[model samples]
Structure formats: structure tokens, C-alpha cells
Target: MSVTKDVAALAQPVIEGLNMDLIDTEYIKEGSKWVLRLYIDKDGGVGLDDCQLVSEALNDLLDGADIIKTPYTFEVSSPGLDRPLKTDKDFQRYKGDMVEVHLYAPINGSKLYTGTLHDRKDGMITIVCEEKEITFAEKDIAKINRAIIWN
Candidate 1:
């Protein structure tokens, strides 16, 4: 299993116990430094205290688990507004909200789409764009993120 998976598996229980959802896990390198980033969330949102709590707990757990041999920085954070919606819960939660969709290949001559999220069902996602509902197979989507509207 990958380090991100391993760490996430080991840390899930603790995150749930703390009443937070583990949004995503990323194990990446930046400027020759390895970083383990855990994105967490709750009903309203997550704060610094929540991040610190998970960090402290996971710090102890990861240290004892010895999952990574190299030096790494551990970080716990919120999956901010633009974070991708990867789960059914995410889709349901964001229903009726504006979202940006990127496809693996162009659909209707466009690789990118911005619309009101409608629903996700049986491996298909439906969105409302320009008052017309369009459905796409979930597999065709490269990513779906909560749209950041400046106005």
C-alpha cells in the first residue's frame, strides 16, 4: 500500500474519534522536503484547533507506526472551498451549489464546465448549465471542485 493510504488507514479512527471527516491525504515532496498533508472537515468547517488536534494525535501515531523512513513534515488542514468533491457525501452536500468540472476529454467541444451541481447517481453525475441539465459518466470527469465565485 502507498504511504498516504497507510497513514490514512492508521489515522482514520483517530480523526473520526475527534468528530471530523478525513477529506484527503497527500504524500508529496516540495523543494527536496517530504510532506504528509491531511485535509479534514466537519459540518461547518475546521479551525486551527482542529488541525492541531489531529496533528498532535497523528504525530504520536505516525511516529510509533514508523510508516515513513525519510524526514517529513506533517500537516493537518481543512479542504478549502476549492477542494475537489470526490465522494458521494461531497456530491450530496454540495447539491445545488455551483461547481467546476474538468473532463478527461471534451464534451460538447468543451473540456471544462461550470454549473449548478444537480445529483450524482449510479456512477453518473448531473449538472445544470444554462438551464439545461447535462449528465456525464463519473469516469469521464477528471475533477469536480466547489466553484469559487468572486462576486
Candidate 2:
């Protein structure tokens, strides 16, 4: 398995024990440093204490496992306001919220769409855009994120 997946596997129990959802994990090299970022969340929101708690526990787990040979910075935090909708639970949780959808290919001459997330069922996602509901197969989506509305 990939380092990201390995680290995520190690971190999952620790995060869940504290009642937080492991939203995503990324292991990447930036400049001269390798970084392991863990996005976590729970009802209402996540706080610094929660991040620190997960970080400490996960650090111990990683150190004991020694799965990563290279030195890396570890970070645990919330998935912020414009987080990506990665799971069915996430789609359901954010139902009625505005979202920006990017498709793998253009749908009706457009590759991008912004609308209120209507529903996800039968392997399809429905979004209400411009007073009309547009349904797209989930496989056709490249990315779906909560829209960051200003004002």
C-alpha cells in the first residue's frame, strides 16, 4: 500500500477513538520537506485540541510502526469550509449546501457546475442549478467541493 494509505490506516483508530472522522490523508513532498497531512472532522467542527490529540497519538503509532523511513512533518486538522465531498456520508451530511462540481468531461458543453446539492442515490448525484435539477453519474465527477461563497 502507499505511504498515505499506510499512515491513514495507522491514524484511523486514533482519530475515531476521539470521535472524529478521518476526512483525508495526503503525503507529499514540498520543496525540501516531506509532509503528511491528515484532515479530520466531527459534528459542529474540529478544534486545535482535537488536532493535537490526534497528532500526539498518531505520532506514537507511526514511530512504533516505523512505516515511513524518511523524515516528515505531521499535521492533523479540520477539513475547512470548502472541503471536498469524498463519501456518501459527506454528501448526505451536506445536503442542501452549495457545491461546485467538476466533471471528467463536459456535460451540455460545460465541465463545471455550481449548485445546491440535491441528493445522491442509485450511483448518481443530483444538483439543483438555475431552478432545474441536473443529475450526473457519480463516476463522471472529477471533484465536488463545498462552494466558498463570499458575501
* Top candidate (TM-score): 1
Off by over 4 Å in 2: none
In candidate 1, stretches whose alpha carbon ends up further than 4 angstroms from where it belongs are: none
lDDT tens per residue, model 1, 61-145: 8999999999999999999989999977788778999999999999879999999999899999899999999899989999999
Question: What TM-score would you give candidate 2 relative to the actual structure?
Answer: 0.92
Residue pairs in steric clash, candidate 1? none
Candidate 2: Cα lDDT at 144: 92
Query: How does each model score on TM-score?
Result: 0.93, 0.92
Candidate topping lDDT = 1
Candidate 2 C-alpha error for residue 27, in Å: 1.3
Write model 2 residue lDDT over 1-151, tens digit each, in one string. 9998988888888888988889999898999999989999887778999899889888878988998899999899889999889987798789999999999999899999999999999989999999999999989999999999899
Note the Cα lDDT for every prediction shown: 0.92, 0.91
